[model samples]
Target: MIAVLRTPRFLLRQPQLGDAELIARYLNDYDVAGNLARVPYPYHLSDAKAWLRTRVPGLPVEETNFSIELAGEGFAGHVGFHRGPQGPIIGYWLGKPFWGRGIMSEAVEASLDWFFSASAAPVVYSGVFHFNAASLAIQTKLGFTETGRSTLLCLARGAELEHIDTQLTRSVWKARHT
Candidate 1:
């Protein structure tokens, strides 16, 4: 089973069935879904349910996803990693209501700490759509550096968009945290 991770402001845990409603509600907003490469626009509860049902625990760290939960407010967003063709890629999203509060930054940092501690991967990969300045800012702040650019299909946009590829090496992350 995936162990729950705690931060000062929130909890990062495996996605639960109860999170479906909030996940759908948040992703339904184009502002949120549009930034994500895989989430379709007009996200529905069924989509959330189907996605949640697929989240199996005991998987490798690279395959696990975490739901970000506020103390009393419940599901706020998600942060996790998945295996990409090149390496392990990290991804995250926060509800619009939770935007600009540094919530995602905290969650992502904590997730990375847990991730690096739990695995032997030397680097983590991530990227943002060219238009996603806020998300890019969060990543850069956490020691990620741009590697290049390429287009990826944004399901919400129904088109491929320029994606800024980035990577955070274990040495860099360690330097920052130390």
Candidate 2:
């Protein structure tokens, strides 16, 4: 089973079939989808369903994803890690209604706490499109330092864009948390 992670404001659990609608609703917003490298624009329910079907629990920590839920709000966003060319990569997105509230920051922190405890990976990789200052700020606040830059395809934008790569060593994360 995928372990559920808790934060002061939200519960992070495995994404369920029922969450497909909200997932589609949130990602359909270009403002949200455009920031992500893999989500196509005009995200649809079927798309969400297809993606949800791919989320298998009990996998390695690096392959797991979580759905962020509130007491009454249901699904609010997602945070998790996956295998990347350089190493394990962490990624996330939040609904528009939940933006500018420090929610993602809290959620990412909790997720990282869980991640470091569960995996022995030396570092976690992350990055943001050059235009996503908010996400970059969150990464920086969490001890991720820029490693380099590269061009990555943004499915929503349908174009290649500059990506600012970052990495957080387990020691750095432990230093901040301790």
Candidate 3:
């Protein structure tokens, strides 16, 4: 599929109706599902469709929830932003098999670049389960700094959680201008 922005190895695009199974297989892994708050443990096709159907309030469907697609090695992961009280909240996840391959970092950098370009705001933010070293490393590689923290109450996981809050600012991006 044609994406709004295609990185050298990944494609940042809108979610398609038929991507249910593709989304489920990667996310349903217990190792993978534990890191994110929203994705269910079972990760059914219906769950994928329900998520895809969630549109931003008062905004059209196209403006929200962009999915990151990896085409070369397969559709390996997803990246997207959602509305937050402070600003836009960026999120992403790659299947465990794709970990350590530098795939998610490429996708995240591309997503941050796009977010900075599209918004008047000068920064992008991400949060991760503090224990997710891989995600923290990927965010660091993409120029995000650990600037804050929060607790996420995961009903599915059935616990209070501590998460690392990371941010990439326009100033940082400008400082590293390519």
Runs of candidate 1 with Cα error greater than 4 angstroms are none
lDDT of 1 by residue, 75-148 (tens): 99999889999889999999999999999999989999998899899999999999999999999999999999
Instruction: Report the lDDT tens digits of candidate 2 across residue range 113-144.
Output: 99999999999999999999999999999999
* lDDT, candidate 1, at 20: 96
- Segments in model 2 whose C-alpha atoms lie over 4 Å from true places: none
Superposed Cα deviation of residue 35, candidate 3 (Å): 0.6
Model 3 lowest lDDT segment of ten: 55-64
Between candidates 2 and 3, the TM-score winner: 2
| TM-score versus the correct structure, for each prediction | 0.98, 0.98, 0.86
Colliding residue pairs in candidate 2:
none
